[model samples]
Target: MNYFNYKRRLSSETRIGDIPLGGTNPIRIQSMTNTNTNDTEASAEQVIRIVEAGADYVRLTAQGVREAENLRNIKEVVRSKGYKTPLIADIHFNPRAAEAAARIVEKVRINPGNFVDRVKTFENFEYTDEEYALEIEKIRAKLIPLLNICKEHKTAIRIGVNHGSLSDRIMSRYGDTPEGMVESCMEFLRICVEEGFSDIVISMKTSNTVVMSQAVRLLVQCMDKEGLSFPLHLGVTEAGDGEDGRIKSAVGIGSLLADGLGDTIRVSLSEDPEYEIPVARKLVAYIKERENHPEIVAEAYAGYSPFDTSRRETYAVENIGGENQPTVISDRSNGNFELNSHFLPDYIYVGKELPLAAPRAIPSIIDVEGWKNGKNTYPLFTSVNYKEIKGNAATIKFLRLSYAELTEEVLSLLKEDTTIVVILTTSHVNGVGEQRAFIHTLMNNNCKTPVVFNRGYKENETEDLQIKAAADFGTLFLDGFGNGIMLQNEGSIALKSIDAYMFGILQASRVRTSKTEYISCPSCGRTLFDLQTTVALVKEATSHLKHLKIGVMGCIVNGPGEMADADYGYVGAEKGKISLYKKKNLIEKNIPSGEAVQRLVQLIKDNGDWVEPDNN
Candidate 1:
């Protein structure tokens, strides 16, 4: 991958119905239906809605041979309605269903983590070389049947692996790590290749943006090493609803898209499936705009590793770098402002004057001419004027610099100043790459000045701003760069909205946490209960637990394994029943649906993790 250049990764094309993916084709957008597969009309209607909402493909869950057979009826209905969009069947744990679905739909998605392996026991078991080889042979034996079916029907298969569901065989060998996720997918791909089957698409999905992005990068690297160039599918599974969902999905999927990695993408949200299409479209369009951009000339920095998630090493500058959580700097330079106590920014940049009535505790950044040495105030200097404070005794200062301003003199000045926090910005069309080059230059020159990423968007729509900003800043943060973020927008977007988005991007990148993080999966046919309503109920009850990570999964298929990192889980065990979990450990089972929310609250309180919501 080129850290400073914008170029798409070339991959072998795979056909799914009429639309082909990868190679020189455009990046495709897709979504799945939540309607019951057995209800042909409802499923077909939902599929049409998704397709009409700008999706190139639509998928429906097939949990058994029965649902798999129903896909034929759904397909017939959709085709009769004059829609030629490709249909995909999402299968988990059942080989018979995958085989049956392969004969019906354009594509069949099988989870390699559970397709043939036994359900995860979370046990510590060891496997010798012979045992591991036997396991692979077992997987091959089961997978060959589906491979033959796909080949016979000319159906593309996606070896989708989720972070939460690695089989015990893999966990015992590789643990629940990104490398393990790669091996899980690779194991199946190798068998497909051995069987002379090439209609393949691959995905690595997880709720954690960092893990999802890293695993996909590693998957590409592993595939390249083995002489494979299969088209990749990207998504962050269980990425909640509303702004949180949109921002999180963009952060993960957009980062990969910016690297020119993904061939097709899905924005998984807890909202209606059709609503997910626009967000996915917006994200894809935003990244595609960088194609054929002006060349960014720079070599990859040896000090930075794209595969690693460690923060770049730099000395502390008060609370801006080193061990500090990345700060948030609000761009209030336009003078329209409101201070939000719950979402207050660490600092506000007021072009030339400090607000007369604003609190002084949260520092303000004034322009160089407006520097009056007020309490907790810092001056903003361009690279040219930064030298005026060469020997000053100020505790901290903000120096705004762009990629072109990083010269030898600036590098020397940065190295000499321990109090300078560089505010990095870029005007190039390939902003992420340009800003990344700035960071790489600093690292290569051995400069330790803490740097904050600043980006401005002219988008008028909230979703567009969210998608664009998240992609820009999220790319840097996910790569373990940036000491803080400064988001500026010239549109009619409210200040509070921008403030919230800044924090949302930070939290989505896993660099900071300012609100509750919900890992809620999008509903599918296998879901035992109403996911959307249940999610809202759960959030209403526990949204105040700012520090807790909660998982609200639809069914057991995505329950324990997908939310592996969550602190608590509310999963559907069966019809009208809910199960509670504490970090993958089941605590309560078969609670009535009506009583589940209160019980979840009680469980949190019992575990000493609950907090009362502030009514103020």
Candidate 2:
């Protein structure tokens, strides 16, 4: 069997300008300069930096032909100086800018999100079906000439779709469902196809990594079904700077790429775009090694999912070979407890039906060895009183040591510089009050780089850390496993059961939902229809959005005010109608709930702009 046959296969030789995207090409890495396009020297310098750091292609915003004028000089100077990396122009709201850019750059990224139509008020939100068709035609009119110029110049186009700037009708109709996202992709693809263009790339992005992943999965699924295998560019948009962005990007992009998806990938850190290349290279290498080798995959699968069944667990590990092997480093907790890089956590799904009211606080930290393959663990950085022992041993209780005993005297004495996994277990250690006190002390201590503990969900919060953990893999976790240790100290596996009690506590708990947390009132006299049923239905319908936070409130007086943080909302209003909101600003007056979800999903799907609120 072909090694890359299990699922989606990214094109190995696809092109985006001179930058080959997939099919057989090296996975391309790209980033965009934050420098204003008009600043030619600064932008060119930054592009040079991006190239030196391994970026295959770099992009600059070309909002208009005025911007393109500066780019011509910038692109020329960069190429003349000996760098041949491709230049891509990101154009929005203006097709003229695209045409100008086609004259100088090798690629152009057209954000369907911000591009406008002939009559623009409707660009702000969803339209009636007739209105939608009319607007689509208007956009085509604006875009086709740009497409023709790109074709003539042999430049590539990227129909980059995102959440914040979609057409109004898309949001009104689809309300952010996977269906909505795919519809938006198809809508643009169909138009591009009609225009006789194929040198294209596609992407759907959101700030939420989970949602981005879901949108990608849906897009790829549809593309495969339709046999339309255009190259894909993967990204997690608006992802924060530094470590948080890296983790989120890894989860979303890495997860999809791991499953044999993604072509050219970008890890959108708020840092210098030049910093994106190394991460991109790492993701591709991991995927390539996985694709070319089999035993490595099997070995990784064995470690992450040692279960006897053939079913693929949340993560499947294969010891596939070459330099492309998955990163799995091993060290033991205090020298005796063995730890794998992929530490698997046992989980179960305990839905909203928690027979009785449960504990409010759950474990949020995990302390254990490293996580490799299917093997997973959370590290906790809290203190423990287990007896000190030599070699691998679980000291059930170790106490009677004052802070004075834990000084330099104790630090230098017990086998210095050893790895550790403090397994917090109920059977081996039990004391909530003591555990709480230890948690405070641990947090107050030196930074706990990798803290793992018993993590569970609050019936009230719906989507907390545990839910977040499960959501990272797109699965609902119900039960927690004893492998529930957090990496409180450094080293993936640290010796010494310093705080195994926390692990015991966490593994004993349960999990809830992941990402796109929803919080709504139970509803009262202000309620028009059944608020109970509405909340349930909306949750059921939009549960898969994964990256958006939605709120369903009752009553006009408080609904919008309460959900100031919601991405999309439905508030009860007078006459069995409801108000729609995006953030704190209300975008629409009142629409029937019967069609609200569908409408909102579509709006979000198009990566469209919000319709101006109807003050009346």
- lDDT, each prediction: 0.91, 0.52
Q: Which stretches of candidate 1 lie over 4 Å from their true place?
A: none
RMSD of each: 1.0, 17.7
TM-score of each: 0.99, 0.54
lDDT per residue for candidate 2 within 32-123, as digits (tens), equals 87676887888889899988998888888775789877888998889889988888887767777788888788888877645663211222
Badly placed stretches (over 4 Å) of model 2 are 1-8, 117-126, 295-332, 335-616
Residue 336, candidate 1: how far off, in angstroms?
3.0
Residue-pair clashes per candidate: 1, 132
lDDT of 1 by residue, 422-469 (tens): 999888999999998998888888888899999988978999999999
Model 1 scores worst on lDDT over the 10 consecutive residues at 352-361
Residue 138, model 2: lDDT of: 79
